[model samples]
Target: MDLREESLYLAPLYSRFPLTIVRGEGVYVFDERGNRYLDFASGIAVNSLGYAHPKIVDAVTSQVKKLTHISNLYYTEPQIELAKRLVRLSGLDKVFFCNSGTEAVEAGLKFSRRWGKERGKYRFISTVNSFHGRTMGSLSVTGQRKYQEPFEPLVDGVTFIEFNDGAALEEELKKGDYCAVILEPIQGEGGINPARREFIETARYLCDKYDALLLFDEVQAGIGRTGTMFAFQHFGVKPDMVALAKGLGGGLPIGATIINNRVAETLHYGDHASTFGGNPLVTAVANVVLEEVESLLPHIRKVGDFLGNLLRERIAPLDDVLEIRGIGLMYGIDVKSNARNICERCIKEGLLVITCGKNTVRIVPPLIIGEQEIKEGVYILEKVLKEGSG
Candidate 1:
């Protein structure tokens, strides 16, 4: 139960919550003391199945018993099937697998740069306060000064501009030198900011006009998080290339870069490779995740709307709660003060929550969570906001 070992052995990179969660099921996770807390964070949207779901467990168990991994030199059915499912879901042509979100972003950048190789185009444009990933290349496109300043001398030729600012984006695109325009359909880390429909439409237009690729970084907001297969579906817009992770593997480590024919046609053998990517275990579980997510989509849409309405009617009236904004289940409560303390205190009150941007409480529960859990999470959040306890 003691976190002494973790403190002694692990790197100090993560600012962890105090509880040592040992097990989870449905929408509740238990600490070492066996205290069950409602989990609204869903491992920051990674546990799409809400923990220990029979389908994911069965697929993984059967897969490990059969084969755990095989290199890219050979073919595997799990890999092929998952790729097919993702391609079919996003209307993308092919998929490249990797270990995490940042890797997928890196692969996307490479694919874009390669597609524009003959044209001598290598520049990228991303939005301010946007979060792609932490690796050097993805970090280069990330607009947060805090994350980029430390890792100076990143992959060059990336421009950071304002989110939902279409005219500025158009000005940059008019140069016709960018390889790709990478965007998060909904900026999750930057406080649940959804891209304006007009902005995205402008991006598609400019990318077409400039012969550049439009890439979507759906790392946090994809895979039914927004009550759809992808958030781009919400705006009825499509990106040529999409990078996905977080919820793709149902709690397993996996990342996928799905691209249409424009980018795929240019990627020759050995242009990019991942040793353990698309291995049997993770992909098999991911297949199950896709199946489950398909079934849960309608339920997600209905319940997420109910939950959003509940928050609007209840939490939005509070003096400290400024606004409730988001799509589907990926909502955030913009607090006037002390959002981080509210998250930590929510853990103490038998609930789990996390923060994004500066003062927004991110509420991305599992796609399978029902209405009752939403009320409970908000109840705890309201209590925390009232108390403002750290």
Candidate 2:
């Protein structure tokens, strides 16, 4: 099939792969020609349970028959239950749901602004090389010039600090002009960089001292992706707010901004709302997804260690491989050559991976992936790297 002809009517936004996926099962996706490929990308970290998961299918199918959506003015059982579960797990007071990760970031930004408005604080401190979202507010704090340059005059007063620079964060917070310090515990789009423990601790301390909110963007690294419920758990420091999405609904679209009581109390009724936020369909699936993730936390930790060791022993020795960085199931293999070319070659060899940053190949397989599957995927990666180098 000619992609140009097939995509003539669609928006030219994505540089798509050549193959058209028709179905997926377990950790593999089948293209239109019925060729199966190990899907390590997992829809860019959204398919936590892989495709055609029985529980997710049951929840989605059952909910569609019962109730798919209802107004926020009315309460739905699934939405309420999921909110309670997230609140309990997050140790946060309330959750504001939206359709995607960017919306979650937008809500987090608004909540911090409103909470700090009366206190004469409005600026936001984000890190350099971080990615929040594409919308105006989230884009302003994204810290990537490539994503923000086209959309100038964004929500002002967001300052970009170096990631993991504790002194810079403290120096800025000392000014007492910022409302929030937004960070991604593991920088996903910025090359799978994990935050140093001391950096997060400093952020927590300074936020409390300056009365600023510490917002964590866990969209890419949350939901058992990092072997923990949330990436910040590894450091033993909690944030004032957390933005979650990507894997929350197992495949369905959902985003949530979990806030503490202090921020929740500052906002009154009608201050913010979403038309289809936390609708019955997505929330019901999210309930199952959360439960399944909690159960697999132990497995994730075990396999995450296995994967790390396997990569270091196998792929790390390749001539083109430069560096390996990641924690849990998420990893980035920086290569001496173009990462995009490597990803394309992997796709051709019946393995699916994606590129992050400039020369890094990112691997974020399903949380349920087993040792055998991991070996299969890594074998293909090794073959691709050797062939490319040769």
Say which candidate scores most in TM-score: 2
TM-score of every model versus the real structure? 0.98, 0.99
Q: How do the residues 1-390 of candidate 2 rate in per-residue lDDT, one tens digit apiece? A: 667785678887788878899899989999989999999999999999999999999999999999998779898999999999999998989999999999999999999999999999999999999999998999999989999988887888988899999899989999999999999999999999999999999999999998999999999999999999999899999899999999998999999999999999999988889999999999999999999999999999999999999999999999999999999899999999888999999999999999987679999999999999999999999999999999
Off by over 4 Å in 1: none
Any idea how many clashes model 2 has?
A: 0
Candidate 1 lDDT, 1-390, residue by residue in tens: 567887788998888878789999888999888999998898998998898998888898898899998788899999999999998999989999999999999999999899988988989999999999999999999999999998899889999889988889889988888999999999999899888899899889888987889999999999999999999998888899999999999899999999999889998988999999999899999999999998899999998998889888878888888888899989888998878878888888999888998689999898999888888888887777767623
Which one is best on lDDT?
2
Kindly report the root-mean-square deviation of model 1 from the true structure over all alpha carbons: 1.3
Off by over 4 Å in 2: none
RMSD of each: 1.3, 0.8
